[model samples]
Target chain A: MRPALLFPLLGLTVALLFAGSLLTGPAAIGLGDSLAALFRGEGEAVVLVMREIRLPRALLGLMVGAALGASGAAMQGLLRNPLAEPGLIGTSAAAALGAVIALQTGLAAAFPPALPLLALAGAVVSVLAILGLAGPRGGSLTLILAGIAISALAAAFTALVLSLSPNPFAASEIVFWMMGSLADRSMLHVWIALPAMLAGALLLAGTGRGLDALTLGEDAAATLGLPVARLRLAVVLGVAALVGAATAVAGAVGFVGLVVPHLLRRAVGARPARLVPAAALGGAAVVLAADIAVRLIAPDRDLKLGVLTALVGAPFFLHLILKSRGERP
Target chain B: MTLLALDRLSVTRAGRPVLEGATLTIGAGEVVGLIGPNGAGKTTLLRAALGLIPAKGHASLAALPPARRARAAAFLPQQRDIAWPMPVAAVVALGRVAHAGSAGPADRAAVERALAAMGLADLAARPATELSGGEQARVLIARVLAQEAPLILADEPVAGLDPAQQIATMQVFAAHAAAGGAVLASLHDLGLAARHCTRLVMMQAGRIVADGPPAAVLTGAHLARVFGIRAQLSEGPDGPLFQTLGLL
Candidate 1:
């Protein structure tokens, strides 16, 4: 488990899953034919399935998963809490609220980008609120408390929006959207989220050194010349842009951010810097695998990506809590 | 040469002043012990001096740019926190974060030297969080040592250590000073301070009550007035030893 080797291994896993995602749909296109259609765009039906249908879905899976994973790693590093994630600070919940608003008002159906745009707006508002409430130099406890308050408010508002939906179909749409999916995403969806995800990933990647210094505690890290305030800003904005754009497109995908980093931390020797790229790749792989599982496990029923991840991740979360408790004096 | 200078530095926390117009200077090749009671602002002064918090006056090192300030002084906080179970070597290597892109053989050598200095060579591969409190303290000390800054500010760096480890840790600070660096350490062990520190600054009620050589500052009158304690002072083979007799 040398750090150098871990990256390539994770990369291979992601590639395999990406390919698996492309080949695992209901059409049963051969791997060689799908690969050829993906590259050459020669056959009409194969090209239609590979290029128009599966490519965007698989690509979105990679981007969203990478975003969640990297954001999760950065959040954990900043808070110095293993359980910390993008959702803990209300980014995902706020995004879900935004998407729910779009669905409730029927704007998402009318305008293609409204859902993602409104979701990103929600994420931005929640992040701004957290920063405003916590202030620049507020300690971790204050930040977490603010996040909790924002999350509760967002969750309440979302439920209210759902309860007051004009029609039962809108309510169902809202509920299904909250469950999260990579279904029916097109190239337009990829284009919408790619820039924000890239920006967020770059910002999170830049925080490696600051995050490493934070292991010594905030005071010590500050004394070590880490621009702690700036670091917090970068992480918050990064997670907001990432999780926001993700929720905009895929609805409220959960657990990939929280679980991926936890799984890869030991492989990177618990170094936050090393975990960033590793978690990014691992996240993409997890999402792709989960998306594939959703397709295969319930082919006829649209099994949501978030549901599968939560099903797997919730038990893992419990196991971690139990292990942590056992380790405590 | 003066490595660190604080002029009229004051700090107020929660509407109450914790350090009031405290001024001190540390010269290269000096191990200065900051001795005070629980709420006497020793930790506050160190924190302000390192620019970890806002202060009324000025700290010369704190005025520098963050990168330069980090290169100039290394700080060890009162709390020993290693957030993750990172390997000991990796934790020690974190000291070079400020010196990023320049971590050549010299940085590795310095880290290795620090590990050896703190008797952590054998445990370099072990998880830092899994170690005992004393071992963790030493590991953090090793991190500071690897920082190789000209000035060091340590808040209770030797607390929870065994007697031998405490002496050994103090000797490391003394050695750092002897090598032309400067150290200002907040310590509760009066005996160790008297033996190892080149000078002592004693604070009471958010102010420096005494500042001089240990023998001049830790006298019976100052002890009674500042600490509200009676002490019996005697000269041991290693240095001046004082025993607390009773509360005054």
Candidate 2:
């Protein structure tokens, strides 16, 4: 328990932010009242809004952020590249398409909490496609290409579904999903995203040592008693589960995985164990900050998280590419 | 732990045979040097022993399957560039990951000893990406040593070192072997291999051409045939040595 990496720090931060997330909203809620409503269970309307709506939303975001961050760290460490990001290969996009499919087809309205599961299934499909097409080069660029291919296919399928649909509601919902947002999301959305994200977080963190071994190189990692195939499968499933669930709810929030993990690599010194947790905290911080910005900056406009992150991430990506190219020749 | 036993191993990489068939054994307290011309499979043979590459053969380390085969066999690959900026201590600690869950008090002591063994105690705080190539070599060797494993495999480990650094690096491997930890190192320099290693395994093209003591395996004729060059062999106070006379 080094003081810098002290578990207390995590507990304190999570608790403080968890309360902050509940307290701060458009409804002019205060900490004492929220706490009283949460415990006493007397202020029914206030309690429902606080407990049922805001609390679940905050918890879902926390879990999703943690999942994306952990998986992103594991992915980068596995590929041994700083520029590698989780969804660059298509998990998030596929998840979005999956959610879109469920919503546009009326399955989500028919079966609550199944949209994220649909997203999960789509994520698995895209991950499988990437692995099959990539041919085990296992580098960042190859994974990115595989992701792009899978994403394009999934996107086309989603667009086709929307175009063929007769309902205007379905088409508008598809457009909302395409842009990506977490607005007016309900309890069902929270339930759909939380479990998958939590499971994915555990699976990804369990591979922290394996990811560290992978930094030695794939061949070396296998030789070091890390079950490479099992780990790979776990990474794919776990990332699919997390990203799929998150995208189902949040609608394709890009580069929180990439940006948060990259930033924390420097903070935690790039050891996977330290990096994973640090990235988790960093991702939560980034998403929370972004969510707060979305609320404050454009209350009426409904700013999409995907758009904001991409706007931020694209420039960072260009900066990275330039830096990498500069270093090479 | 035994160094390694590779019984009739063959490897195919990308549908082409890299090592057709090779059988080799390394024993404890022995420094074995593997040398050959380009495409010689010197690296392949060592990799096979360590189970880095899949091979059609029986490769056994001390503790067999179900348990990890090569956990005791630490390796340093030919060409490695650190992708992330890792601190020296953390990189060295990676050696302990295999043993971390099961480590006794002894393992921790060994890690510290390995750090001191390679003279990296001072540079532990420094970032690995910042170190000089020669220093990086020492740090990597320190990592393998920290594994506290019985056998160490290094592929072309001293390729870029100056003569002094090369000799200094050889001494570290020599010290590991002297401490009853076996070493199977792939090398290019005939002189360094002959001087430091107890035995030599020579490959021409994916096959072992000669396997014997340095004096026998590194004869002028073998050097000329395998490397296609002339070389002078000498008996020094230390041991048999070689000096390469430009290409034949």
Candidate 3:
């Protein structure tokens, strides 16, 4: 497909999925009624459900999904590896660790913004650590190895925190938070994460040209006048803010970032620059669809969004591995 | 006028010197072949000249601002890595990255011209990674050509090409020089260097052991002393013919 047509198609799909997300739930809210309540604030119960509950859910899904998708694409482009994702750099794991701390200490229940704030802090620390570990001229191998070590450490610490929690209630809360969800979010959640996500998305967007140059390799890109150090900084900070804000709002959602970019890369002609926006749109659509499916598949049970994404994404990941193996000589 | 000048440039890697006090100047309309045995700092010199690595002393091109430096000189590294399977055209278009937001008709024309120059016009839509090694090398060379810089630094740009393709690639560099650009290419093929390069600079043990015209620099004594090889030099119809007799 031509690059011009690809964006609009992805945008329309995301819009349709957004609408689908808003219309789904236990209540029998008709599409027309939901649209009316969403736009015109008609009918008391309809307005309450649409405004206070479903609207926030759909908005979070779009924002968080877009963040993960764009971050994933940027990560892959920077590392020049197709399998790279937001989680690879330890941002998601570190953010999850922060949120787990908030839950275990009962700070999240006491204060609403404390969860995301701490999570963002964790992401910032992880970015700093990775940058410090991988020096200015460190190659991709060094960066990847550093990220793996940081991720493993964060995961271990998070597990330790959960195991040592004072009560089973706190442990369960931490477990549920780690499972990832979009339930009971408010406009406050949207307002808190929106600015960081926007800033991160802007940073990632500016790296398109640099990322394109990087296809030639780092030395060639540097010689092409790309300040490779600055590019790395921007990508790291941008991904940190995005995945941090995302995990803060919706727990530790996985696979959307890793899966969406891989799926849309071919459609974008495998150009890293074009894949950024396409993956963002595709991510939003996938997350919204998954969120909707979660509601319909098991309405009585509180089905987690991360669980469903893993259920779908893990198989796709395996298939990609097998396909790659088959193509190898 | 000198398009590139290196004044006593020196580089040390892992606490060991790789290039020591290497002074050279490449004038416009000259193709200077950097010839040296393995670990003789040919690659290091090109990299340091392009500011890809840290070194002592000064490289004139490295002193310019990054974008201005990029516009002034295009570099092709020793490694030809195409990480993604992007189309040939898209990969070649990456040369215009430094000129971002300024691309217009001229940039498109340059890309088309480069593709044609490297005989890649027919494979413009093919995935770059799917191409053969020689084809991929040509594509990368096309990418450098599209940069349209006044100076070009290429490290082993024609290493994997067939004999015909190798000559054609050298001719492309010669043509670039004839069009008022300066090219400093590191080469291992003594014969190609003797035939195509306007001048030759031979290095040994992190220093330039000889620098002059090919006929003056690639003599039997220098070959035996620097490369530890006995070479027979004779004049062929086209240019100087170099034949390695045996290891000294």
Give interface RMSD, per candidate: 0.7, 2.1, 0.8
Q: Candidate 2 residues B1-248, lDDT tens each?
A: 45688787888889888887788888888989999987889888877776656788787752265125546777788766566678887777777776747356666676678778777889888878778888887777777787767788888888877788788778888888888888888998888998998999999778888999998997878988888888888998867768888898
What digit string (tens of lDDT, one per residue) describes model 3 on residues B140-204? 99999999899999999889999999999999999999999989999999989999999999999
Give TM-score, chain B, model 2: 0.91
- Give one digit per residue, the lDDT tens place, for model 2 in A54-114: 7776776676677767668777776676656677668887887888888987998898566
* Candidate rank order under DockQ: 1, 3, 2
Best by DockQ: 1
The estimated TM-scores of all candidates read: 0.98, 0.91, 0.98
Per-residue alpha-carbon lDDT of model 3 for A14-36, expressed as tens digits? 99999888999988999899889
C-alpha DockQ of every model = 0.89, 0.54, 0.87
Better of 2 and 3 by TM-score: 3
Model 3 chain A worst lDDT run, 10 consecutive residues: A135-144
Instruction: Assign candidate 2 its CAPRI class.
Output: medium
Q: For residue A101, what is the lDDT in candidate 3?
A: 88
